[model samples]
Target: MATQNPPVADIETAQISSQTAQAGSTTGSWANGAFQKLKSNLVFRSKWAELNGAMGDLGTFIPIILALTLARDLNLGTTLIFVGIYNFITGAIYGVPMPVQPMKSIAAEALSDTNFGVPEIMAAGILTGGILLVLGVTGLMQLAYRLIPLSVVRGIQLAQGLSFALTAVKYVKQKQNLPKSKALGDRPWFGLDGLVLAIVCLCFIVIVNGAGENLRRGCGAAREGSDQRDEDGDVEGRKSKTARVRKIIFSLPSAFIIFVLGVVLAFIRRPKVVHEIKFGPSSMEVVKISRHQWKRGFIKGTIPQLPLSILNSVIAVVKLSSDLFPGKEFTATSLSVTVGLMNLVGTWFGAMPCCHGAGGLAGQYKFGGRSGACVALLGVAKFVLGLVLGSSLAHILNQFPVGLLGVLLLFAGIELAMAARDMNTLEDAFVTLMVTAISLVGSSAALGFLCGMIIFVILSLRGWTKDKPFSTIWTDRSTPEQP
Candidate 1:
């Protein structure tokens, strides 16, 4: 009897041959299987990895950065609770798992303009959330999407990224004790401490990447050799080796090592740190609001926030739709409606205002947030955190050094900056850069967005005027028509 190839093998072979012919690259089922397994492990089983990765992404970084920046202005206790709540809601709606804290731009404005106390703000948040819920239920959120233009929306996001990067640098400078140094008549450069921190963080990132690469190479080598032995023996041996290696690596507790090193370095240097960094409260404290106070404050606070929240939602949808669904007829109205509803539901349970967070949603998609289920997982994590340890979360976040936060944020900003470069035209790129610059200079994301929009409008109007029928009379006959 002639030996025949198994049906599965035949199908796989055909697929591989087709792909190889089309792309000049060979792929095997074994490799696909390994990748699928690794992906599954990273997403489903590895909570720490998921958390860290989410936090490291722009979505988490933006809120955390904001939190750190506005630490002095806002109540640490209230902010922590707000973050947990916000994260829970955004994670659910956007299908991106990450914490959303107080937006520094909004917080600063609130601090300056709103006389409402922390309790009142919390109440207002509750009301704003209710409004969102009503809008969502009524399906009005979708309508909001139609109102905003993609260019303006993205202009704001790009501006936000610039703002974040500039703020990170500022924070780093402050922490490093770098001065304007006008007295010395020397051009400003990185302070001694800032330079040291930057070098250390860079080294840490490089080391981590190197270690990961080495592990991957080792795994590949082991896989290549596994077929030499009896099929079953080879598989079992390979599995054992993989498990052992993974176990050793995972059990090493690298975070502990970094912490130890930091402690040791601090003790040895005893250098006078320029800025006093406060991470969070020493302990979690839950302050209960009376029913009367909650009711009165909620009404007073929420009414003002509704417009801002709506504006935020509209801006977010426009930007997201532009990049994710470019050239497609994305209904801004529909997105706004969806987000509005999500916000309403989220706020009822003490969540923060839910809008389309540019960084979180974008980062989640970048990190493989493909479906609602993935976003649901993020929501679940946030919900759990909020319900179980809302207050204490602040304290935990506070423990991270400003330098580390700055480094993480800097990386996130760089990622956004790179993404901005994908714009099709120089005009768009200029708009993005200019918006970012204004936002950073003013130290306000919202204001930066407003300025960018103003510029966009002015340019758009100019283009319209030039395109008018009468303008043709003044143009040279030899000049080609403008697109």
Candidate 2:
């Protein structure tokens, strides 16, 4: 009997596996070989760009962490330690600025209830992690990745980015009686992280980001239609005044600067933070879970996060990674396995449950992170903080300006939404838009995903009414135009 060819998706998966194995086999130790591969790659450059990019996801990261630590009494030191290791490992393997973030649904449920403590959080993480591991190990994640339409993925990205932008705008805009906010509406506009400082920070980040893109475009344009000799010539005019200005701007590391300023302001606001700081690591222990706690955690946290994790964490992250770094490809199975392993290993010690996020990836890319070094640098910082200040780091983070985070989140959100720009067809665009609208209005990505899949199936069946086969309808939209 003639053997049938495995599907294209299968072939792609096989290629990824082979490449990784080849890379790992190069050295005596697999770990060393992977690191050696990363060392030889230019995309892993550690520079000011990495510094700026490292802070890109912090806008979303800090708030959720603060909420988890301050609200639920989770072991902050242990969380950072594991997340730090995860960052470096993810950066090393992926060769891009992959992000590890707290599960939003889990964070929300954990924060809203006073009764939801560390044990429940750990239970939820274990359950979610176990399911993801099974999905990845059994190859079900790869199958799901192939089946989900690209339009639906774009919709998820667009909706998430817009939602973040909206939330950021709210953070910028001050309201009376909201003392928990970083900036007060009643304060002097020019005083301490109020509207004026927020606007200034926003302007600086926008200018740096815009100027860098312009310089890159100019260089690309100069290289176009050039002879071999001309191409060899310095296209970016190293000595030019304009080039110097662009270099200086990029070197400023706006996100890092903003973050440091926030920390300073936090210290100023709460001088007692210095005295309260204990110079040691927080103890790590497996949170004891009751049978009731497991059920409650699963129902309250895992169930809400399951669809979000499936759609955003695994599928969307894989899709977005490919789009952002065309030279690099990521597998949904790999991402699922990593996320699953992260929570299973860490949450036992009361660490926050984490996963890959598209919004975080977009944020890093927007902030000049073209390489894995950006995340690795961030990992180093987290590692140091965990070892030194530990949970006391939360003291400063608690007072970290909400307005600043809002500014950062605003840009990250917009950046994530821009990933949907590749949509070239009307029906596909409409489907993406409708899904985004439903997600934002209904306040649920799962709803958007369910509706998107249903709408996609219905729209896809249009050709079937004319006696078209299912494969024709599937293939027509399955191979979307690449940007």
Candidate 3:
């Protein structure tokens, strides 16, 4: 037996080979697991879902981009490219359709103030980004979140929704023709085809969303009934699948269809507008800044945006992400980091100021995006368009019906406002409504936040001895468990 045994050297070589093979197998498995996560996060075959998600920010994106480029002389190339790249990165990292939108306060200020130029815009973005980075790294976001009452945050959201709804209504009316006596300028009486089309689109959205909800409820009821019978599992599963498919088909591309229909209608009805478009490479130049410009930008651009950014971009985004994608936790700190990073990097290259908006998230979720694949797809589209169609975008968008765009905004606003309904108690609702009214009337998030804080302090002092302490208002610890 000893003579038959393999030599020691041969035995050692065999052992080494076996070990190598085992190690290779392990490495391969690890690589595969990582690749699978990437695939799941970034890739999907659902074209409709991707398109729908892309449509979510069109309302905000279109108006802001156009206003910046046309009205403020902002560089379209830089804005689109930076935004597209940032969106792609965000999608890959977050695995959700978390949107990157312009800071509305800055945008409004920049658009309104003729003196605010590239330098001011850049300063504002850089300063905001720096502040956000500091907040994120220092964990101040959580501290801030803990300091603010949930009702105050809810009120900001409610006010933003109402404002957007009003804007949508205005857009619809903008397209409508008025009587000769009531007409503003050269407007004709009782005729504007886009308004009719927009009405149809709105009706379609309502019907589809309503039907999808009804179908889901019916399936849920059926499942409840099936729980009594052991063999009904398969039948229930089949029914669920059917309902899901129907819902997806109906609800997923509703906004996109409306948008595309608008474009098509525009082209058919107004080919001249399309013909005027000039397709060419976009011309962009670097932005220059001064100390004085930086100072003004910091005050007007950065300060006004701080409250909204903290509440909507950081706090509301975290809440919405938690609600829509349970177990996929997002934090105020992480959001701040991204927002800061994007602005810091983007401002250097002449990009528009950007942030993660709660409204954009609501809009995306209202569509069929459960995964980042939706935004990833959107990113790809954005990059391609920015590179290939940047110059012609203005003309193309000009042809697109504004009223239809309004319909999209209308729904997104509704979804965002609906999130406020989570505040159940009457006292909370009253505080939120007060904040909403103040925000709407004052047109200021900072003002709304201040008013809410003051109201909360008064309420706390009035009932300081209650079993539910005033401090509970600031802490989410007592929040009723959400399903």
TM-score list, all predictions:
0.55, 0.83, 0.80
Identify the runs in model 3 with alpha carbons over 4 angstroms from their true place.
Answer: 1-35, 43-45, 175-193, 211-252, 273-280, 467-483
Which residue ranges in model 1 land beyond 4 Å of their true spot? 1-51, 57-99, 110-116, 130-144, 176-195, 206-314, 321-356, 362-396, 430-434, 437-483
Pairs in steric clash, model 3: none
Candidate 2: where are CA atoms >4 Å away?
A: 1-35, 41-43, 175-188, 211-243, 466-483
**Best-fitting candidate, measured by lDDT?**
2
Among the numbered candidates, top TM-score falls to 2
lDDT of each: 0.47, 0.82, 0.76
Worst 10 residues of 2 by lDDT: 217-226
lDDT of 2 by residue, 1-483 (tens): 999989999999999999998877764486776667778543545476777888889988887888778767878898899899999888877878899899888888877776778888889989999999999999999999999999999999999999899878877776322222233454346666688989999999876666334233212122122223333465763345554555566457778889999989999878898988999899878789999999989999899898889999999999998887889888989999999999889888888999989999988887767777778888889988998999989888877777898899999999899889888998799899999999999989999999999999888776455656665766766789888
- Residue-level lDDT tens digits of model 3 in 141-256: 97887788889989998998888888777766664221111223322223334466667778987755542322222211222222333236566544455554554445446777
Model 1 per-residue lDDT tens digits across residues 315-369: 4644553665354333445444554454444334333343555555444433333
Please report the TM-score between candidate 2 and the true structure.
Answer: 0.83
Cα lDDT over the full model 3: 0.76
Supply candidate 2's per-residue lDDT for 94.
Answer: 84
Q: What RMSD does model 1 have?
A: 14.6
Ranked candidates, highest lDDT first: 2, 3, 1
Candidate 1 Cα lDDT to native: 0.47
